[model samples]
Target chain A: MYKGARVETIVSISWETLLDGVKKGNVRSLARIITLVENREPGWKDAMKSLYPLGGKAKIVGITGSPGAGKSTLTNAVARDFVARGYTVGIIAVDPSSPFSGGALLGDRLRMRDVVTLPEIFIRSMATRGALGGLCQGARDIARILDAFGKDVVIIETVGVGQDEVEVVKAADLVMVVCVPGQGDGIQALKAGIMEIADLYVVNKADREGADEVVADIGGMLDISDNGGRPQPPVIKTSALANQGITELVDALVQGFESGRNADSWQAQRVKEEILTLVETEILDYLRENWERTGDLDKAVEGILEKQTDPYSVVDSLLPLIREASRSKETT
Target chain B: MNNKKIRVLIAKPGLDGHERGARIIAYGLRDAGFEVIYTGLRQSPEQIVSAALQEDVDVIGLSILSGAHLSLTKKVVDQLKSNDAEDILLVVGGVVPEQDVASLKEMGVAGVFTAGTSVSQVAQFISEQVNA
Candidate 1:
């Protein structure tokens, strides 16, 4: 129905239909809707608009740890526990995009063959898309979509590479930092990023030789970080392969979610971010629609790229042109 | 074989950070002619789902060596289903036990590759599934 109108009208119709399907707990529809949104097609905003009101019912749990700490196996165990308890779960697994190929190689489901077929469970894989923080905003958006779709628990898994992992810590109601024994720095490396955000610390692969030492290291680090005001994060040992300590880990998750004040803080932060995202969408839409019409944005980009003007000056020049166009449109 | 690269998203869900396997898989898949998106460690289920959707990937592979695999994969599958991405061939590889394999498959997982499994087997399986 839309003819070269910048955005597709089918996307909007399908989006609304998909939202309706999701609200009804239709699995196929849920998957399709997510695909539309994740692709960020022109009409994704419309689908999100329809689905946004349906989200936020889900409890978001974040699990992070250092590389080689068995976080995925731990997450798999926890997810099984949640399902056993009769909760519909959603998972958001984050990975870094391949710089060379611009595509992703997401294998979070590799170990989860048995669980992935559960009719009640939903899973989605996301990429950083070169976002500054490791936790991609696109991931957050899809989480909202899943939440809207009536998932009882939403688990967000991040690749703990650099600041992005820390950013994920900001979004979770309970942040579990998974660690293993025998890393060169032990829990010391975690002390900087993983330790600070943990509601619970998991010493995974506890069957390994240095499991005890890893736990002790974490204990020592926790002792040093006893800031008095913050409740000390608990450390539990588990061999995800052996299915050891998963129940306890789930218990800790429940306890942490039930007790954390920071969850409320995160809720507020998410709300603020949602507002900013909507604003960003509108601004970009406006720029795309009007900038070309006025022929000013191209000039600004050219000026900035050509070194004839700095970014700040380009923005300064572009703002007045936009303002004048808006004023003219308002009068017209 | 047309030699078309299969784009894959290898992600870590929740807070599980054992990424050596994930990294190796990423590298291996890339070498096998699959465009691998390896989000270099510690990712949320939401982030993972979003990435797969954006990239229009044929498969979404999760590497969760953590015991939380049940919860993480369930969440990813649930989210993918919720977004109409149930067809995206969800596969998991890492620290998985034999007993839980059935349950994971029951949850819509197409494949489960545990430790000692050859990366080529994975790449080949993915190739067949995506092609099919």
Candidate 2:
């Protein structure tokens, strides 16, 4: 009877039930809980608090590259390999949200058709959701949810626009930056910022002409850059479409994880960064709500439009009011 | 804190090879300030319901051009009910016939849009249903 009631309450599932389902490896329950946390539904924070300790068992991998670099196909190939190796893989494919409508055309699954049906694999597409750094606000939390749900490996694929792509480094234990042939100066372009974040560099579509040139370019760039006493990231060549080089890439990823296992300092740093990000998002949200409720935000905008006060000055004046609001909320 | 943007899933269920209607509706919903997630062609009822639940969408607009709306929509509706997700606003759009509109509504689909229906009409209907 209790089991029937539990089955009947799927739509309005409680957090306790969802948590139990997650622990038991129920895909539907895991998907539902991901929605709850992603949407920040009521009691979401409590859910996170309960699930956090259950995480830390899964290996998180971040894959990123420029648009049109075949990131999705590469992810699909890698996922298939992981599944073959007896690992439960969770994939988070991030796509850009339309700036105008704030909606997203998440076509990542189209390229992932091959691995979508695998019983051990779960693939989810995410929109940037106005989060500037190639990832959504709840992506890390979602990854944690997958971790706690018993996935052995969780892979996050970024939207792959430069600079913003670096954000994935903070969330993954190993970050793979993928590049392709025929872009000519593309390898050189990546040298500035993105090259540094790579735990492994993959030259995808290696069967195409100019693949070796891109590989050499990356190798040349890696040699020139100062690693500050750390070993340079390995560069692997792969044609994801042809199902080549994926095993080598996955092996390197596993090796990277093994080497970094005892790196307590990096783990601590990641936790600190996570905490700061959460606090920053929450405080900004609180400040925005307070300003809007007090009508100060609208007033400031009006003043700026009327040319009565400059934007910086408006912010300066509103700071005290925001501070006061924070104080009052704390006391209450 | 309740300024949550509406999320809608525009899914193509069954083996409908033609996706022009679904694509158009996805674009329309996005332009209307809703976060729309488009699940491409050849989705099963189970896949559609799973996507909706995972996405936590407020509204699900099913686009079916293949004349199997009754069975497909019924399967999706039944899955939603079993999952306790019947509260989600279920709307269908495509080459739906005038005669079948009442039956779709009877099967728990909130609204049905047929040929010649403008994108704004569908968007407005969804907004009203969600807000209501």
Candidate 3:
């Protein structure tokens, strides 16, 4: 019995089969392939190359906010509404990974129980995986996979911490910055970083006291910031627990996407960023691999420890090797 | 690579309201350098299996204290087989008797940790099984 199973394992699942399964909307296949690409498993690049063209159909929306802003609840409400509108939704909730253990406690999906049982909704919880920008590089790839898997909308939720979180949300077509009452000082501090990334400002937990004040604070900030004469992003109040203002939020999101549909320049800029990121990651990986293969990295570290060569001089010495590695990779 | 951490999904099946064991195991596994995805309470076999697939977890540790271990484990194992994911290591914990451990093993559970099993012991079992 185990012999046949061992043989099957030896012959890994083919890319064609996985791609066909994704096209047919098989959730298992979609899930499996997403894991493959997210881990950058062997042949992952080929898989992504095949699915890249099939994406861009789904409307990508990003929800980001402070740790206690009820981002997950708001995301759940928005996704539920999207499903009710006869659209399939995919959600990516990102949590921080532990630097010490290289592990993550992905509890965001627990808060999203409301939409988990819905057949039209697929929720995936991801760790930042040591990526600096609040999201792993695989996030964009996973979003594309979800888009290709036939979801009409994909929501990327990140814990808004710093510039990294803002950079993560910039990948979305519509970005919502969530604020809750009693976090006035926190929200005010974030206005310089996260506030600028919002295409819409959502005052979540509107049932709490000072909800109106928070909304007003956001409005006041918008008045002060010069938005280059463009219409200010609308600030909407929502109680995710009570499910208030979700419809209005959805409508605003749809209108936002509609109005920005013809903005090819913005889309081109996003693509440009994505391409640069991809190149940077690939080149770095190649350089590391080459250095490791040649024992140069260890030698360089030893030299630094011995104070034989300064850090800048070490890098200068490594530059020629890195260039040679890049050339070799290009030829291959 | 050697640095890659193992991912585990600790799921509670069959409407078990008790979550202390699962929570402890989740934290323990995380501290042991495993990315643990905890599915909270009251998960169906389908939900558990779907999560394991989507997360690409190397191990699935089901915490069932509702006396439905045999049936739930069978359903989960069957679902995993149907999804071509039988290679995933499966474990069971919570209120299990020695007599039923063999039965669970027969149903494809790799290990069983009853009450009083240390978190490190459970983590060690999982790490050994997955790496093996």
Top-TM-score candidate index = 3
Best by DockQ: 3
* Candidate fnat values, all: 0.13, 0.28, 0.39
The candidate, 2 or 3, that scores higher on DockQ is 3
Over A136-206, each residue of candidate 3 has an lDDT whose tens digit, in order, gives: 35678888999999899999998667666877876788888998999755365355477666789999999
Ranked by lDDT, the better of candidates 1 and 3 is 3
Candidate 3 regions exceeding 4 Å error are: A1-11, A132-136, A186-192, A261-264, B1-5, B81-84
Report per-candidate DockQ: 0.09, 0.31, 0.47
lDDT of 3 by residue, B1-132 (tens): 113557799999998799999999999888888888888999988888888877777789999999999999999999898888887889999999889999998888888999999999998988777765
lDDT of 1 by residue, A67-139 (tens): 6667666777888888998888888877666666545556666555445656667777665555333245566
Q: What number of backbone clashes does candidate 3 have, counting pairs of residues 3 or more apart or in separate chains?
A: 0
- Tens-place lDDT per residue, model 2, A121-190, is 8877777777633253467888999899888999999988856577765788888888998886648448
Best-to-worst ranking by DockQ: 3, 2, 1
* lDDT head-to-head 2 vs 3, winner: 3
Question: Model 2 — TM-score against the truth?
Answer: 0.88
Candidate 1 root-mean-square deviation in Å: 11.0
lDDT order of candidates, best first? 3, 2, 1
- lDDT, candidate 2, residue A264? 54
User: Of models 1 and 2, which has the larger TM-score?
Assistant: 2
